[model samples]
Target chain A: MKLRVRHVSRYVFDAPVKRLAQSHRLWPAETQGQSVIQWSVETENAVTGSGFRDGAGDWTQTVTVKGPVSEFTVTAEGLVETSDTSGVLRGHRERVPASAYLTGTRITGLTAELRMAAEAALEGMDAASPLDRAHALARYVSDHVVFAPNRTEPATTAAEALEGGEGVCQDHTHVLIALAHAADIPARYVTGYMLSTEDSQGAEASHAWAELHVHGLGWVGFDAANRCCPNEYYIRLGSGYDASDAAPIRGIVDGATQETLDVSVAVTDSARQSQSQRQQ
Target chain B: MAQADQNFFNEMLNGTDVRAAYENLDRWQANMPSDLRSLKQHEAEQLFRRVGITFAVYGEGGDPERLIPFDMFPRVFTADEWRKLERGIKQRAAALNAFLADVYDGREIIRAGKIPEHIVTRNEAFEKAMVGIRPPMNIWSHIVGIDLVRTGRDQFYVLEDNCRTPSGVSYMLQNREIMMRMFPQLFVENRIAPVDGYASALWRTLASVAPKKCEGEPNIVILTPGQFNSAYYEHSFLADLMGVELVEGQDLFVEGDFCWMKTTEGPQKVDVIYRRIDDAFLDPLCFRPDSMLGIPGLMNVYRSGGVTICSAPGAGVADDKAIYTFVPEMVRFYLGEAPILENVPTYQCAKTDDCKYVLENLEELVVKEVHGSGGYGMLVGPKADKAMIELFRDKIRARPQNYIAQPTLALSTVPTFVEEGIAPRHVDLRPYCLVGEKIELVPGGLTRVALNEGSLVVNSSQGGGVKDTWVLAE
Candidate 1:
């Protein structure tokens, strides 16, 4: 699918936050089930950074601020070319068998849960394509867990939310990630901004979703929050093992000022003409 | 001062350019005592950059290179100075070990009223979970890094005691390797004692405290709180160097008063753990209940003598910045000898008189949190403006017992290579001392350099850099 993305986030503070640095991992990871044919990110008045690695092994950049009242705007226009396939569990697939999730029941770390969940979800999914299983798993998670805002931290796990039955988009994505891993799919957490239909003229708020890697199709995007796949409204910030690893902005400051931050984001449907033309 | 080294200072003052004076062949040679030698300034800088001996400065925002500043010149310690420092470090470590053993077991010092009970009871780091628990070998602090600063000629002072998973040993080892390559000729000529054996010494220290049941070949692992910890590099480096497994908290579990690590092969018994996690995060069952970085009942195994944790839990009792005021006193009381190293004049804010004095002289004294490290909870009175001083005064007044005040000593300086040229920068040393079955101080400790001019703070989180410390045989 070809799509144009517009993401904007503004952070207003009670006091100015100097040395403002941010890292974005939202660019869909290049893998098997998903592929990006052409993508370019443009920034205005803000320094676009790259080539720095944080704790989670993702490339990041430190975006300095003009002042305390700062805004980060990212616009990506791209054609996402995706394909999916499935056959015998070969090579690495053999190691992470479809039965591994059933046998390894106890999932400890963030990555381990994804592995187990993918295996479990993929248990009977031998006949389907990698994207077919991923889509199924994403829908299943949305049906199972109800989305509740401000209920979990960025590091909250899929199992924790599934057991608790409450979480935001972060938890939904993690639960889906776990289920995808159980189905033998490699998935990652993505942080970005969601464009609101009501605010078609602008973006809505910061958002989170998940991407699953199929054997041949590369990495395919799934929004467990909206229970649909990503289209033109999603603006990629960064992706990681979990949400905490890809927070839009995080850094330390001196001079002992109590920090209160307010974030406002906006994304608009840049492909409105194309969709209207198809309707006509 | 009529010292022979004074002439070098005069010659530098006479030079048109201070940068040229440090780099000039004749002046640089003359600055070093005939006995001391090192590489040319440029060569040393190249070696440091190549070795990847760097620290991640916490708040410097963007550039990775801005994290840990590196200098060209290595700090030199004469054989005589090293001997004195080694003895002082060993003595202080021994006294501290004894103090920890007593605090957790007998509370002899408390009984004698040497240290106030309220102070001990009110400490944030003082864990009730550690009470009545005696580790194997009865040693609490198996490893300690005693920070020392030499302000004047051979006058060494104990800055602070780092008994809690003290980092920078990896940097110490890495720095020395770089120093050797940069100043190969100087190293051979000076015959500096190699500190490369620290890993082996550390391994032995941890092994000696291994659980009794697994005597012949005990399984020792280095437990880290995970990669988010600021000291994660040190934890991994030490583990790799010691050839031991580095396990995260989740990788460990307690089964019937025994700790075991979950390895890929199977559940391997962990007899000894060089734990880098803080005491509060060591066990969810015993410490912070919400901490996922800790095993639920790992402390139960340690208390039951089924496992040994190096620099045992609650060893922070002696490391408390308030308690630091009494270290020299503890040394005198326990060892029955005067301290080899002097302590900075410290004032306990909890005391009525000292609090009054600190409140009166808030702008002249450096106030620090009793439990804080990494240059946090510190107010440099001299450098601080009136508002900062007022803010710190209020903090101290609100919680007198949690703070301590000290006279800011002019930390000694060493010639360091900077972008402009070589200039004198304040630096401090932290020598690692191992006390297992025996006490062994690594020949050279990590020399932390304050990169900013006239700055006394040398924490990596701040803009401080590091230099290889050479303990010369001469």
Candidate 2:
């Protein structure tokens, strides 16, 4: 499937931001599952700085703007060809070992409740394969937490999400990753774009999931919020220990008394390519 | 109270006979009048105060900024002695750089089973952000300060390695300056090797590691945390001496894939940053979100080769006390050479047998935190009382992985002027090694003397003082 994605994030401050700097992981991962066709990231009234592929197999770029004026906007547009690989992430160059992912983060640290839930999910299935256990844990997370937008804050931990019993994809990914680690499997949180079939207009596109490193299969993606593994419709951008680390955009504004943020992302199938092929 | 051990090696005296290194100084002292000596001492203190050479002591009730007492007696070293120290310091620096590059890139040492995987992976000093980001010239620690302690005439052991930002080079320079000013005749009589070239050498070392994108002459600046930092004087002093702009985080920004310092005229591209801030506080967007002392996208610029950060982020892992044990192996593995300097025999409390031994010998060992610095969070076993030893035992039992124990060596002493006149005081040396295209160091280093009688701790914050180190010309 060929998908085109456009993501825009704007920040407005009540007072002028003396200085602003931002880091973006907006480019799609170059792996067997996805191939980048073309990608461009730009900012208004800001200068886009150096870009590099980081150790985590993510393309990161820096942006900075000096302003006595208020608003700053970052726009990322890209086209990527993706294929279904049974949710298996392959051929991604990362220097960190699988054991490094087992290190729990502040947001995904396993609580007693998370540990119990993970144990319960794998009960009577001790003889199953690691992949099977990972899938079972994903299912357990999906069933335990209802998908409800605005139910939790960005800093909400897996323990907090489990107690609340409802959260968005971020919370769901954190909970699943916590459980995966509790089961002694290395896991990480992934942030990317998902082409939602229900939203034909391709709005509400930003998504997050969890990836468990199964011994034989390598890293396998699992989306507990959708109760399935990511397919051709998903574009993987980056992975980290938790939501904060995996955030597509991390930034800081200096000398601003107050600031407001707005984000919009759209992912849709490219009709122009299909039309061109039909004409040919 | 404990007393100085008579068996310890004294740098100035051997069985009440002055060593050959101190012969000239001893003769000069005998000829000098007592009133003139006191006058010179007062002049030295006045000069230090006038130059604004002071260190900030946090959490202290008295004045925060206090001058590190300067001793007039110079610690002299023969050319042969200095040659060995120079070679060892260079070898250790090279090995440390090689270790950092390997750990971040391939982990060949870990794979070879020379060092444990968990020790590197689980270490808090091991930054995940620096996993595959190689710095300019593949050198992580551009400047290193290796702490050396002497127990005997030929026995020098590395106590710790400061791969991160090492302070006291400024003190080394200032001590020499004050000595030359107070006693110009002594400098002419004794062919002391010149140390005035360190600032230029440091500037060249930083310039040699500029990013590939830097064109022509690389623009260099010193990034300081601010005046409140304990090492602020060194920061400003180095910057002035190197003839570069001294900037705080607020004075710099990232734009157009490059880091720019906001000059009085406008923004100027910065190619190299001699950063004195810690890694966690170097980039807010990458490492710590709440850090106001760091530029937001500085790490991204660094990873992209836009600006070179001297002593690159994550270099701290190589100096971690737990990892220090593997440096010898690194020397053999990376350089195919034996370590020129010996590491003090260390007992890692994390290991079962080592923990058992450390706990059993708590009264005879000096236990230190793996991550602690500046003589903080340490227990000198011999001086510690029973309750203090017991307290450390409980702390060690709770987190065995965080502690390391070493037998207290009888540190060598130098003759220092005290209230009761010249007496022996324990001392240690910290030589600054600059690594870039090549490893270079001045012959002499900062020799810190414990002011208190019989005290072995030489940290300035713990009532220690500085002395001029003289490497005699051949």
Candidate 3:
């Protein structure tokens, strides 16, 4: 499936700044299952700087804006062709070993409540394979934490979301990661885009999920929010220990300007392009 | 007077007679008048104060900026002794650098079953960000300060390795300056090697490791956490000596994949940063978001080969106490040689047998937290009271993996001037080894002496004093 993704983030500052710098991890990962057709990231009032691929196989580019301007906007648009390999994220170039993901981030640390939930989810299922266990853990997290938007903060841990009994895709991914880790499965948080289909729930361009490293199959993505594995409709951007690390955009402004941010993203299937190319 | 341990080596004395290394100093001290000696002591204190040589001791009641008491008597090492120590320090530093490169890249040490996988994988100090990121020249620890303690005449054991931004080189330099000013004739009689060239050596080492992108003369700067830090004086002093800019996080910015230091003139490209800030506080975007002491995209710039960060991030994993036990194996594995220096016998509480033994011998072994430094969170078994011992026992039982136990060896002593006269006090040496194009070290090191009578702890933060160490020229 060929997917087109557009992400725009606008920041309005109360006061103008002398300098603005941002480091973006917005480029789609180059993987065996996914290929980038064309990708470009642009920003108003900013000039693109140098780019490099990080140890985690994510292309990062620096942008600088020297201005007294009160508003700044970053736009990322890309087209990627993805293939389904049964959710196995193969041929992804990441320097970090699978065992490194066994460690948890502050946002995914296991609390007593999370530990109890993980233990309860795996009770009487010890004999199951690692892959099956990962699926069951994802299902358990989805069931326990109702999908409710804006119910938790960005810094919310898996235990906090589970205790509150409500969170969004990010929280669900965190809870699943905590549970998966408790079951001795190496898991990491993944940020990407999901193309909405007729049979599927309306998918957001910005999506998060958990990927567990299975003993025999490598990393397999499981989206607890959609209750399915990542398929051809999914376009992976980057991965980290948690959502904060995998965030697509991170920056710092020089001046102390009270700012408000708005983000808009759209992930669409390029049906028109496919039909036009076929006719030609 | 407390009896001195017969087993411990006294640097100034051999049984009852003065050692050859201290013979000249001993004669000078005997000839000097007591009034002049006290006057010189007062002059030394005044000089230290005038020069603003003080360390900030946090969590204490009184003035935070207190001078580290300087002993009038200097510690002496013969040329032969210095030669042996130099070789050992170089070997240890090389092995440590190799270990860091291996752990971050191929992890052959772990694969070869030399070290446990969990030890590296589970360690918090092991940074995932550094995995497969080859630093310039593959040198992870550009500056290594190896702590050594002597027990017998020829016995020296490495206590720890300070690979991450080791402080106290300033103290070493300052002590020598004061010693020369107070006693000019003592130096004239003894052929003491000069250590004034260390700053230049350090500058060259940093310049040699500049990223491949640097052209012409690489611009180097010292990245400091600012004035409030305990080692701020050293940072500024070194920068001044090296004729480099002393910059803080706010004084630098990342642009065009390179780091630039904000100057009065304009933005200056920084090719190498001798960062004194910890790894967690070096890049806010990459590590700790709440850290205000780090540049926003410095790590990204470093990853792009836009700049070189000396003593690269994740170097601390090599110096962790739990990993310190494997240095001997690392020496053999990397250098294909035996460790010239010995490692103190350690009991890792993570092991079942070691934990059991540590718990059983709580009063006889010194238990230290694996990640703890500056003599904090350590229980000296012989010195700890019953209540402290019991508390530590519970802590060990709760988290056995966080603690390591070692037998308290009799630390060597140097003759120090107390209120009465010269007396033996425990001392340890920390020689700074520079690693870049090559590994080199100054002849002597910072000799920290426990000021309190019979006290074994010698951390400057814990009220330790420093003595000028003299490495006699052959």
Candidate 4:
């Protein structure tokens, strides 16, 4: 599967910060099943400072901002080629089992309501094969947690939304993890960028989803919020046991007494480029 | 000071061998600050940077490579101080281990009124999930780092205990390596006991706790919370030193009641894991459902004894700041022995009398948030301005259970380097101990120094550096 992804995030500050510095952990190194043919990242209002390999062996890029500017924008575009292992799980799948993956994760202490709800949701899921069960689980979470903007400070969790039935991508991912673990399946969180439709402006947006290890098929990506498997429109940044690990960028800033930020992202797949590239 | 010495420092540029680099220490001593303590500290700083003893400080919006300030000069401890520290640390670790065992199986400590059930229940770290889980070795605080501070020449006090992610051993090893090079004559003459065996000992400890099924050749991995963590470097360093694979939660899974690590080869079975991640972030399925840093089914495998997680999940219950004061009692309760080390007199704000005393002496005590670490939410009343003290008073009044207060002590000082020369700086020691099948203390501990002239805060995040502590040959 070939994926041409453009991710653009714009942070407009309430007040311009003087001397801002940051390290971004966004770029994903090409692995065996995935290849990046072309990729580039550009930032406005920030100068690239240092680049180094971090302790966990991830490549990180540092940026320093000499800013009195009201806004900063980071744009990343890449052409990624991913293998379709719908038939057989290979590559990263070998390390994680695809079958009966949910069995070992215990969800005993979770809210009684959530446990019962998950149990009810997985009534027919166990009978289904691992791949189908994963799909069902994703679908159930998507249905259970409504995708709505949650302006909660920092972020909210799956259980918090279970009572309300609404949350953003993070909630969807968490609920999916809880449900999968309830069934004894191993699930992980993925932070990345998802392509936006034509109506949306800009390049790409930060997105969160869940991945389940399916027996025989390997690790399969599922966007519970979208109620579908990750397609060519998805560009994976990193995978963590949860959402916090795979956060696109995390670091500290100095010389600022306080900081308030507003972020916007957009992901668009252009038909013109697709047709032109197909011709080439 | 020697590194800055014109002739000898230049001479050292000519050679790369460890011995040649330190030969100039005698010549540089004359130009150094009059304070021998400061001179040693300056040398320690240069050595730490050179040898790469670093912690990744993730500034909210800055580059994270700012290494923890390292002091070249060590805080020397006589045999007497060491014996007391060893006894205190061992007692504390053993008691905590026993406490955890009791909490999971017996709950005898709470039931006996030695520690109130309400306090245990109120502690945020106390986990209901861990209620019935007894580990293979009945050990929870497997890798303990007991923080100790010297108030006077011979008066050492227990500052705190870090049973969870107590980092900086890597700094100790690397700092000593650099110090030996910078002062080979002093090091050779003094005959410092090598701390290089810590990794091997840690590995042996982890190996000892491997699940019985995979005893022959257990696959051991060091689990980290990933790169962005402040202690990520330590995790990788320990992994490298122990000759084990460094894994993140996503790199592992649970299946068939077994824990498996994702390896280049395949889904290899993992029998033992020295996880640096906190209990809440170790297994999302077991603790916080929102945590992405933990494997979903890891706790299940642990429950079945399919794998061993050292300093097992939920160990934080014993190390809670509020529980620190009871360590002596815990020692007496579990080991039937008097405490070898004494704790700094701590006042739990949760108590009415202590709260009143703390409120009255808000200007003289050091107040700390029960759950905060690395000096994030600590206030020294005397050092703090009125506004800060008032802020602390308001906070404590609002939530007394979440705070603790202790009288500020003149934390002992060792000479360290400054911009002009050497000066006295407050320092503390945290020695790492490993208990798997047996107890082994790393000869040298991480000696943290407050860089600020008169500051008592010695956390790396608070601008503290570390020194290579040496246990001199007896």
Highest lDDT: give the candidate number: 2
- Interface DockQ per candidate: 0.01, 0.69, 0.58, 0.02
Point to the candidate with the largest DockQ: 2
Candidate 3: tens digits of C-alpha lDDT, residues A144-247 = 88877668988899889889988888888999999888877899998987776554432443788989999999999998888899999888988889988888
Model 4, A1-280: lDDT tens digits are 6666666656656666544444465675555556677878887756553343332223455555655656676777777776544312234312121221232223212566767777887786556787877777788877877766633323565666676787777777777877777766667677766655533211213677787767665567888777777665666676554555445654333234444443444443443344111000
Total backbone collisions for each predicted model: 32, 3, 0, 41
lDDT of 4 by residue, B90-207 (tens): 7778888888888656678877889865455446666544555667778787788888877654567887787766776777778777776666777656656778898899888888
lDDT of each candidate versus the true structure: 0.65, 0.87, 0.86, 0.67
- Tens-place lDDT digits, model 2, residues B359-411: 99998999999889867999999999999999999999999999989999888
The candidate 1 chain A region of ten consecutive residues with least summed lDDT is A88-97
lDDT score, candidate 4, position A202 = 17
Candidate 1 lDDT for residue B42: 48
RMSD of each: 22.3, 4.6, 3.9, 18.3
What is candidate 3's CAPRI-style docking category based on DockQ?
medium
Q: Which stretches of candidate 2 lie over 4 Å from their true place?
A: A15-19, A42-45, A66-69, A109-128, A182-184, A197-205, A254-257, A269-280, B1-5, B56-63, B348-405
What lDDT is reached at residue B292 by model 3? 90
List where candidate 1 sits over 4 angstroms from the true fold: A1-280, B1-53, B57-67, B347-405
Better of 1 and 3 by lDDT: 3
**Best candidate, TM-score:** 3
lDDT of 1 by residue, A8-58 (tens): 333434565443433334354343333456655554555443233322223
